[model samples]
Target: MSTLENDSLRSALASTPRPPRASAASAALTFGWRGMLKVRHVPEQLLDVTITPVMFLLMFTYLFGGAIEGSTGEYLDYVLPGILVMSVLFTTVYSGVALNTDLTKGVIDRFRSLPIAKPAPLLGALLGDTVRYLVAGIVIIVFGVILGYRPDAGVPGALAALAVTIVFAFGLSWVFTTLGLLLRSPSAVMNAGFMAIFPLTFLSNVFVDPSTLPAALEAFVEVNPISILATVSRGLMEGNAEAGDLAIVLATAVALTAIFAPLTVRLYRR
Candidate 1:
């Protein structure tokens, strides 16, 4: 290398100042805003939230309402909570898929180069995805109302139900975000997510009474976390919420965050 050019490079390095450290909250919100911008630019990113709930609410209520609950009205009341849970579950996978895509595209590398909180990108993506989850809940409730499904528990009850679902959903996102960091492709993450979610939400007492299942399967359904969550949502929205169901839902959220949050942060830093 030429001496003058080498000295110039050295001088430039010596003169450059490092960027200041960003607070965790600020960094997370910054990246979160970025995540929302991505959704804005790609409007189709909301198909799951916008279209899936309508289809599921209509399909499930009409197809199985009579056979399962003896009437469409009764089934609508029973299934709407389940559908809300399902909607959030469906959207949570996208957090992982989106993260995987960002990693693949070298976006993480850019974030790494910046002077920001290490967990900012991940936490930000999750925060941004909260919008999707909220929209899903609103869509299910609004559409169900149009189809003659009313929450007898009223607005307060409905809001409480949504609050529980959102808390659970936020904790659940960590599991998938970790998967995104570990997986080779977004498709793999999505497939694994659906495989896990479909069974948990479906096999639980979401659509039908757990008593109807075979002895062993019914046992699992009775204690399934999703089942507990759905039960709590139904109770809250229907004015029959029990302390036991609320306790179970809170415990599940705590357990999920305890187990997955550290693992996700570890993988994210890697």
Candidate 2:
């Protein structure tokens, strides 16, 4: 190397101040913004997240509303809450798929190489996914409004219901995030996630009344955590949420986060 060039390089290094380390929150928010950017570039990813709920809402309300709840209007009111739950929950599956994709593509390894909180990537990814849940829920509620389904509880009630649903989705996302870390492929993560969600949604009071089921099945449906969540959602939007149900829903969210979040961190570290 030329002496003049080497000295100039040394002077530049000596004059430039080293940037301070990023705070944990700052690092996490940066990754969360990165996650949001991915959605911006790949806006097509929202097709499934949106289309399913619209289809379910329309099909169920028109096809079976009269037979099930006596009319489409009444059934719209009855089924919208359940549809919101199903729609938002379906979006959670992608959290794992995205995480798995990052891992497979070595994006996560690049995050690991950065000097940041170890859990920041996972937390930020999950945080960004809250947008998907928001999108799904809003689509259902707005469509339901267009279809003449009104939340008797009005705006505050509807907002409260949406808030609870988002919180629930947020808590449940850890399960998929953990799967993302453990599974070898994004497809596998998705398959396994929907396998669990489908049964929970179908078996719950999300669609039909538990009364229509066989006694044993009805008992199971009544006790199903998904059923409880749907009931709470229904009640909140409908303005009749039982205190006990709300407590149970919050407690369940806490339990899921408590169990799966640490497990995700453990697996991430490994």
Lowest summed lDDT across 10 adjacent residues in model 1 is found at 12-21
TM-score of 1: 0.92
Best by TM-score: 2
Across 32-84, the per-residue lDDT of candidate 2 in tens digits comes to: 89888987899888887788889999999999999999999988888999999
Alpha-carbon RMSD to native, per candidate: 3.1, 1.3
Alpha carbon deviation, residue 123, candidate 2 (Å): 0.8
lDDT accuracy of residue 128 in candidate 1: 94
Q: What is the C-alpha lDDT of each candidate?
A: 0.90, 0.90
In the range 114-141, model 1's lDDT, one tens digit per residue, is 7777888888889999988999999999
lDDT of 1 at 52: 84
